[model samples]
Target: MVMGGKSALQQSAERHLWMNFSQLGYYARGKKLPVMVRGEGCYVWDEHGKRYLDGLSSLFCVNIGHGRADVAQAGADQGKQLEYFPTWSAAHPPAIRLAERIASLAPGDLNRVFFTSGGSESVDSAIKLARQYHRVTGNALKTKIIARDIAYHGTTMGALALTGIDSIKEPFAPLLPGGIHVPNTSVYRLPPDRTADSLAEAVKRRIEIEGPDTVAAVILEPVQTAGGCYMPPPGYFARVREICDEHNVLMISDEVICAWGRLGEWFGCERFGYIPDIITTAKGLTSAYAPMGAVIARDAVAEPFLNGDTSFLHGFTFAGHPMSAAIALANIDVFEREDLLDHVRHNQDGFRAMLESLRDIPIVGDVRGTGYFHAVELVRDQDTKEPFSPEDQVSLLGYLSDELQERGLIFRADDRGGPVVQLAPPLIAGPAQFNEMEELLRPVLHKASELFPHAR
Candidate 1:
């Protein structure tokens, strides 16, 4: 069937496309959905031909920007050479080369790569690897995973168990067991009596409470993404690393969104000055040009599985597809060629300042995060840092979310931790794109402040 115009597209989408994490009822009720048709540089054009600045980098995955014909062509060329191949029992050239490349770039001794289809699978794979690593080393009871509160890991059963958000996990009761929650390093919301080190110490306390022998790994993002780009307090990771080492627990850096220049480094852990026993990454690995994810294990972590006839005992069919691997190689090439990491490092301060300028707004409570990733928290009382009621949060975020998009800006208007606007522009975005974001944000947010006056 030949696809028609926007109406037909919307109709088909409403009929067939069950979008992930979207309220299908809205589209079903005939609300006009923005159908993005094309993307280039730091912008994307909807089906109506209106262009919007991609402030969230297309869900924080499109790091090198979009519409790179060269990268797309690389996949096409590889498809022509070898359309598909599996990484189980046998290996292919693209997978082999990409693994070697990733191993070289990963920090410390994280040199072994196990490929998966996306972030959720990578996380699930890490969970399994951590458990198996303990079991093989004669400690079979170590199966629990300790993760931060309100952190979004992934949607798979194992990954969902690892996720800390309560609302999303409630519906899927009886999830994989042995998943424990710890406090995240959200310093903005830190109590007056508590220091940042206390957050790190919470991990130690949780480990002691749970018994070290029962905990297999402690997974964390360098900069927690879901709870409004929560940055790790100073010495947080260093302390966590020490705690994990002392307890013989594996440290897994879940860099699904933080890696590949999102935080001005090849890996987010590098930005925080720590190494992990395993690193589960995806999204920007191929700049989301193709579906791919990997669990990078430290040399020691891989040792138990390598001995004699022991194997990982787990695999995904399309984990290391040739074309996806080729696209990832090409994506890495784009990163190096454009010096995207250096680009983010050079301009991160400017980006932060732009967001910081909004703090004067009556509702703007705090501005936080690092590199291209940042967020502006909305509040009902600036002086008290009082958050909006659930009803008000829905109203405020809904208005701001719609207004921002209608005004040609694409970013995240979230209420995960609180009412916050998350911004993570493409690495290629500079002052010009920053100004575009500010231009779009200033008027809309100011209006929101006026319209949704703080209830005294």
Candidate 2:
């Protein structure tokens, strides 16, 4: 019953589901967890009904796939009209019409939207609104925070001290301090004569050795998704927005998994033209059904809390939850009635030519990413690019994540920084879900390059 029939409330959710970031001692030893239940356009069906192919959208945040009955009837008519409220200091009407429709779909002059309850409280409320908008505009020694190397940017405690993945912040050791880190646009793992203007002058030499009025923000991620889908190079975020506008620093774009429409713009620094001063989104706004997130800023960083009493004193008790802002204004009305950011910018070049035709297999060394957020990268020496020897990256990412979820093709077989696989799918994923994800990723990456074999 638990496997296929899966009833009895799905076997009581493996005894009281504590699931975030899994491995709960393999579901407290019994090991069932694979539930899933249902979904539709773009598939999902587990609890043994099997099916799949939500690919990474379930994590990358559903963009507008999976049985979206008009975003669950606009969160069931805002839970029968205002199910909950609290943008604290009172505000409703679906969080003031979804914060005036995410400040008219965010971009330059971002127009202040706050809210949070996901993407690590919109990256710890845009690093406490960039250190209280530089201490109410007089730069009380800014307050440090750059990010890149293996960048993840979430988990809590000031976005886990701006998380750059030192083994997931080394067992959460004394975090939430200034938290700096760098070098990540990953010219396939840097080093060889580093470029991208020396990684944007290593963020202007780590904000001139953390002395540009004690640097208050830099946080990136136009792509760098969990540090593998990496991207950003060509004039890297226009040289980190000219090194945070010649060091007045406050870039902060985080876009929690590259904003809505996954990567075919609608943010992701407007497909790398660059315009930061804080963005921090959530997994495709309300595409994750309801839980929401935001931050947005830039009316010159909310003009020192728009004058008067000076209040940016952070918030969240389900920040802006009028049924997650009426399921984020009915998920931006299904992303403007299924334009889904121009259908992932007209099928992201056939999903980057079907992940660059898996670069002639042999451990698909580096396909990289752009839209529909790619990855691939596996190498053992695709002519000496040579990665994957952390015990063959946990036995070729646990055998291509259990043979591509037993051949139904759900993605993300990550290794945090190295071995890859990721994919984004579901912005109404096309070309027949990229030919059923390259026919379930080419024979499971051709049997994971023959059980992780490579070099001559």
Candidate 3:
């Protein structure tokens, strides 16, 4: 059970496991990594039996919380009935029924579902769907997609093109072309002349400059996650919808992290009061109990393919896998039975209040977001709104990244959006969970602020 003075699990992870978005060199340097072995409710336990609050919902996906026996049982039962099947030119009961259920829950005419294995694939599929929809409708030149700066769409090549973060995309150069970037709704940093609608107007201007006929779709998250939960301003999406309609471009709501009650609604677009032509979703679709995603298209978008002898040339082997479909159905059952959406709606204000109270700490620059997803932006000078220098960011975020974990809290301390602490606890979380988060966050952030005297 031991190898080189480390447990087999640790050794194996260091030698063989390649974690996503993680620096493997950290583990290779013989640092002890926290190996999570069990999860229940709003907490997860490491191999050493240390319990940490699942504040980020294990990456903003575990909406129903962890270790749901019913959800797991559904997959197991489905496996016994039909272990695996492809939805390509064939249908299974779980996929058929789940699609119908999702359609019923989705807004507008987003009834047709094209399945994928996960979020990245969902985004990739959506990108292709938009282009194909345009091509099929006889607009072959409509190929470009416009996305927001600092938005994390996905990691696949197509999705990567849509991702506006330069750090992650540089090495994967020569990505799919025609991916344009626009300013995001980080209203906290907007200049005085810029109004709330200015963010939405950026999309309009980009579409015009790109030649409206050449832009296939506009992809954006309801509340952008990479740049630390940048929420949309009032009437942003509605204006975007109008712009897209005026230009005959598709609006794609990339709801991989925002859907499935993460925003206190079935879909993030619903929360924002606008319906997109296509919705690319995953994550809470099955509450992360199973890897599944779907690109839901409005009736008009799916119409061309549904015509006689015409078909959408796209699919995945595991798309609508029977077991995942069953798990999704079961997950939805739990959502309805527990009324988790209503739970979030009832509790979101208190959660926001708890995070807002942290503004008393000098390092806390801004507290923003909705429902269960929120972020506390770190700053060096709150009065002047001065950002932390690169070195200061390393010192502040590094201390927080390690200190919060040592304090048995699993929240995100990231500089992806310039020094931020993101929190997206499971939707089942309530006041007690919020209190626990505050207790852990208040001190760690206080200690972090001490790293910069100006912040203190």
Estimate, for each residue in 192-281, the C-alpha lDDT of model 1 and write its tens digit: 878888998999999999999999999999999987999988889999999999999999999999999999999999998999999999
Q: Report lDDT (Cα) of residue 6, candidate 1.
A: 40
| Better-scoring candidate (TM-score), 1 or 2 | 1
Candidate 3 segments whose C-alpha is farther than 4 A from its true place: 1-5
Write the number of the candidate with greater lDDT, choosing between 1 and 2: 1
At residue 360, candidate 1 shows an lDDT of 76
Over the stretch 1-456, how does candidate 2's per-residue lDDT look in tens digits? 435544656467656867677776765565445678899988899866889888788888888888888778877887887688677778878888888788888887888788888888888888888888898888988989888777888888888887887887788789878989988887877787786668878889988987999999889888888757878778888878887898888888888778887888778888878788889888788878877888888888888787788998878788888887888788888888878888888888998898888788877878888778888888887877878779978888888887788778888877887788888887888898898899988888887788777875
| 88 Cα displacement, candidate 1 (Å) | 0.8
Model 1 — TM-score against the truth?
Answer: 0.98
TM-scores for all predictions: 0.98, 0.39, 0.98
- The global C-alpha lDDT for each of the candidates, from Candidate 1 onward, is 0.93, 0.82, 0.92
lDDT of 2: 0.82
RMSD, every candidate, angstroms = 1.8, 18.2, 1.2
Ranking by TM-score: 3, 1, 2
